[model samples]
Target: MTDKAQKPSTRLIAVTLDEASIGHSTPDIEHERATAIWDLVEDNAFFPCGDPGTGPYALHISLMDNRLVFDIKREAGEQVVQHHLSLTPFRKVVKDYFLVCESYYAAIRTASPSQIEAIDMGRRGLHNEGSELLRERLKDKVEVDFDTARRLFTLVCALHWKG
Candidate 1:
């Protein structure tokens, strides 16, 4: 078996978050958004469904009319498909995720290792749920693995805070 690392042809070369849509975020929220985008660009498999031309894409995420918009384009800026997903489906999970995250952040300083671990575990669980939902919601529009979905989910949450 060849141990060659396969190059990801269908991956995001750039990601943009609408600053106006993401108004007045806390430092923590801003950091989370940056990290998620960085991770997604560094390593991800984001293939646009159907025929949207070839590899290497750029993604612009924004919120419009309480819907999440994914404006995809070619690396050189050719227009591709645009998808708008309603935020209603993600409300509960995102809310819970934020609550758990708050607890986990609070636990980091004062709680015991076990306590912190437990809170982090719950936080991860919520994250996974959000990721799964994102994958399911975008299944028809975009094809993304669990990891990619997770990072995308973080971006979703980032947009959701203002929505």
Candidate 2:
């Protein structure tokens, strides 16, 4: 029997965002999308449960039928898992996140340093909440560290953005 240690660790090597689904997003949203993908590729722990294949995975994130889809594949392009999660649970949080982000950005322009910091803190809190919700939603389907989930949540939010 092969020892567990002999198996390759599961991690994401590349990530793609589906443009067709997302349409045209704001520059801020685009930046967030790019940054999240970059951060996720640079460092992440991603393991698809019930899949025996060891992987440096490639992920394609998109929205379809109001669901968030994770199209996962091995580095070699062989498909591993495709999981679709309902967006219903994320709607309120995403909306709230966007609102808080807008406030934070506006605050950065004119609010006092203390005010900006306070807004920033609230923004981060909402972001963390969204990430935690994402982790919970994916618990049965995938195993991911908090940071990975946070980055993934960003991408998910980008996809969820209407404008």
Candidate 3:
């Protein structure tokens, strides 16, 4: 075995949250969703950023600009927050987004290197489909107030990348 010390992996994006993503004021709601979502995530291997977690601890849920933010980090990224969600039925919102991220990563991980390479050449390539899926997970008319959705997009894209 090589004797060199393994380098500590670094994420370029980091997610940060204030007290608003779920709004502590709505503790009843926050607690319920946080608990459920947290549990659901814990069982899964990858996080929004495609990095596996001890659970869902890295997803920073907070309220920002009157919307809930599910901040996430993946693939050498830092502080990449989810698009602010301001629609009702928060449970459904969370559920869809989580599923989309989870499914994408699963596909990316299992695909052979040759297949992954083919992803770039397909008509509906991996990148395009992934972006569409992410976009679909977001509800219409919801407030996704990020200067550039790419911050969150980066997180989604990061999922499936092997460190």
**Clash number by candidate, in order:** 0, 0, 15
- Using lDDT as the measure, the top candidate is 2
Model 3: per-residue Cα lDDT at residue 18: 50
TM-score of each: 0.91, 0.91, 0.29
Q: Show the lowest summed lDDT stretch of 10 residues, model 3.
A: 1-10
Q: Which is better, 1 or 3, measured by lDDT?
A: 1
lDDT of 2 at 61: 92
Backbone clash tally (model 1): 0
lDDT of 2 by residue, 1-163 (tens): 1233224557888999998988987887788788888998887888888878578789999889988999999898999989999999999999999999889989989999999999889899999999999999998788888888989998888886766
Instruction: Residues 1-163, candidate 1: write the lDDT tens digits.
Output: 0111123457888998999888986787788788889998998888887844386889999999999999999888888899999999999999999899889989998999999999999999999999999999998788887888999999988875642
| RMSD score of candidate 1 (Å) | 3.2
In model 1, the runs with Cα more than 4 Å from the true position are 1-7, 161-163
> Which stretches of candidate 3 lie above 4 Å from their native place?
1-34, 45-57, 74-77, 86-135, 139-163
* Model 1: lowest-lDDT 10 consecutive positions: 1-10
